[model samples]
Target: MPQESSHRVVLMVDENSNPFEMSCAIEVFGLPRPELGRDLYDFRLCAAEPRTRMRDGFFTLSDVADLGAAEEADTLIVPNRPDTDAPRAPHVLDAVRRAHARGARLVGFCSGAFTLAEAGLLHGRPAACHWMWADSFRARFPGVRLDQDVLFVDDGDILTASGSASALDLSLHVVRRDHGAEIANHVSRRLVFAAHRDGGQRQFVERPVPHIRDESLAPVLTWAQERLGEPLTVADLAARARVSQATLHRRFRAQLGTTPLAWLTGERVNLARRFIERGEKRLDVVAARSGLGTAANLRARLRQETGLSPSAYRRRFGPSGGEPVTP
Candidate 1:
C-alpha cells in the first residue's frame, strides 16, 4: 500500500498491453516510501473492460477501475500495447482526450506512443516510441516529430520513452521533476538503480558480435574522464586510443551513437552540474574544473541541456545539509 498523496497517477490498460511497462509504472509510482516517511503519488490502474487480456493473452488482469477513473489522474499513463497496428478502443481514446483536456500530464512507455498518437494528442508534438516501430509510426502519423534515437522524449505535458527499459529512466525523471534531485536519488537508491540517465541517451542499437575483434572504447573513455580539465580534443582522444581521428569517429558512432566531442562535452556538463550541486560557489572555478573553459560556455551548456541556470539549479537541487544526493 502507498501513503496518501495529492498527486494521482492512473494507468490505463487495454487489450494486448505490455505487462513490463505496466510494472514499470507501478514500481515507480505505486510503491510506498517508508524510508522517506511518506508516499510519492496515489496510483491506480484502470481498464476499459473489467478484465483485460494483456500482451498475447499471457495473463488476464482483472478487478481494476474503469476508464472513467482516468479523468481524475494528475498523471495518466497510456498502455504500451505491443500490437501497434491494432485500433485503439474508442472509449480509451476518449478517456485520454478528456484527460488531456483537463490538463493532465500524459506518459507513454514503448509502444504506448501509439495510443497517444491514436488519440490525436501527438500530432505536431515531439514523441518517442520503440525504434523498431519508427518507420511504421512515421508512415501512420507523419505529423509527429518522432525521435527514435533517444531513450525518451520530454515534450513538456507529454512524455514518451522509446523502449521497455527506458520506461524506468523516464519514471525516475518524472520523480526528479516533481520532487528534486536529492529525493529522486533516494528513490533510485532504494531501487538500486542509476540516479540519472539523460533522456537524450541513445536507445536504438543492435550491437552484433563482430566477425573480427575490435578495440573497446572503455580504456580511452576512462583516460579522457581523468583529464577532462586538460583541454582534450578529438585529436587527443584518437591518439590515446592509438587510432586515427576518422577511425575513432567511426568507433564512437558504432559503439555510442554519438561523436566523441559530444560525449566529452556531455561528460563535462555532468561534472559541472555535480560540482554545483556539491556547493561550488565560484562560477569560474566550476567552469575551469569541469573543462567548460569559461563561465559563458558553462552557462550555455547547462542551459541547453538542463534548461536551468547554475544558480537556479543549485537552489533547487543543492544540498541544504539535508540528504546528500550521493550515497
Candidate 2:
C-alpha cells in the first residue's frame, strides 16, 4: 500500500469505456474536497492512447495519460469496458497484471470486471458483475466465482462491482476504507448521496409484482432499524413483519440474499461504528445502544465485522475535537 500522505488513484480508461463509470470514479476520488482541508486522493485518468473518444462517439477526452501512469498508483480503477466476452487488448491486460503484481489495489467497475477476469486477476476469487453479463462471464472465465446478488465484492485488494450504480457504492466504500466514515460521509453528503451501503446488499431484488406497496417490507425494516438498540430475534422480526418466521426467512433470503439475523447483526455493527466514530468512549454505552448486549460481545462482534476493537476503532476514526456527540 502507498503511504497515506500521498495515496494515488488512477482511472484506467479505454475506447470502449463507459463515460458514466469514468465520471463516477472522478466524482468520488478526483474532485478536490476543500471542506476536508486537503486532497483525499491524487487522482488521474489514464488510457492506452493520448486522447480518445469514449464509447459514444460524440464525446472525447484530451491529454489522457498512458497506462504506464498507473504503475505507481495506490489504486488502479478499470471502469465499464463494454464487451464482456471479447479478449482485452494485450497492452491493457498487461498493465493491469503488472500493477497487481506490485500490490496496487485493483477495482473493476461493472463490466470492467471482465477486464480483470481477462487479466486473470480474479481467478479463484469471488467477484461481482452486472447481472445481465453474469452468465457470459461465467462461461468465458470459468475460473472465477461470480456472485450476481451483491452490489460489490471487496476482497482485500481486488474490488469488483455488479453494475453502473454499484460503482458509486464501491467508490464510497473505498473512501470509507482508506480514510474513515467521517470523511466518507462528508463526501457523500456533498454529493447528496447515501453515505454507506454494505457491499453484500443485493444489486436488484426479484419482486413478484411490479409495485412494492402492499407487499413492501419497508415498515418492518423501519421498525427493526429503530429498535436496533434492543435485542432482536428472528421471531421478533417475523412478528413485526406480521408474517410467519419461515416466510420472513424466505423473504430475507430471496430479497436480500442474506438471513434476517445476519442483516440485523450487520445493522447493529453499523450502529456501533457510527457511535465509535462520534467519540463514544464508553464501550458498554456504545454496545447497549448498538444492541450488542454487552462490552464483551461488542468487542467480538466489532472484531468480526471490522477487524478492530472498540477502543482501537474509536482511536482511529473518532471525532477530531474529542467532544462527544449527543444522541
Best by the TM-score measure: 2
| lDDT per model vs. reference | 0.88, 0.84
Q: What is the lDDT of candidate 2?
A: 0.84
RMSD (Å) per prediction:
3.2, 3.6
TM-score of 2: 0.85
Top of the candidates by lDDT: 1
Clashes of 2: 0
| Per-residue lDDT of model 1, residues 200-243, tens digit only | 87886545356766578888988998999889999999999999
- Output the worst ten-in-a-row residue range by lDDT, candidate 2: 318-327
- Model 2 ranges with Cα > 4 A deviation: 1-5, 208-212, 219-227, 231-255, 319-327
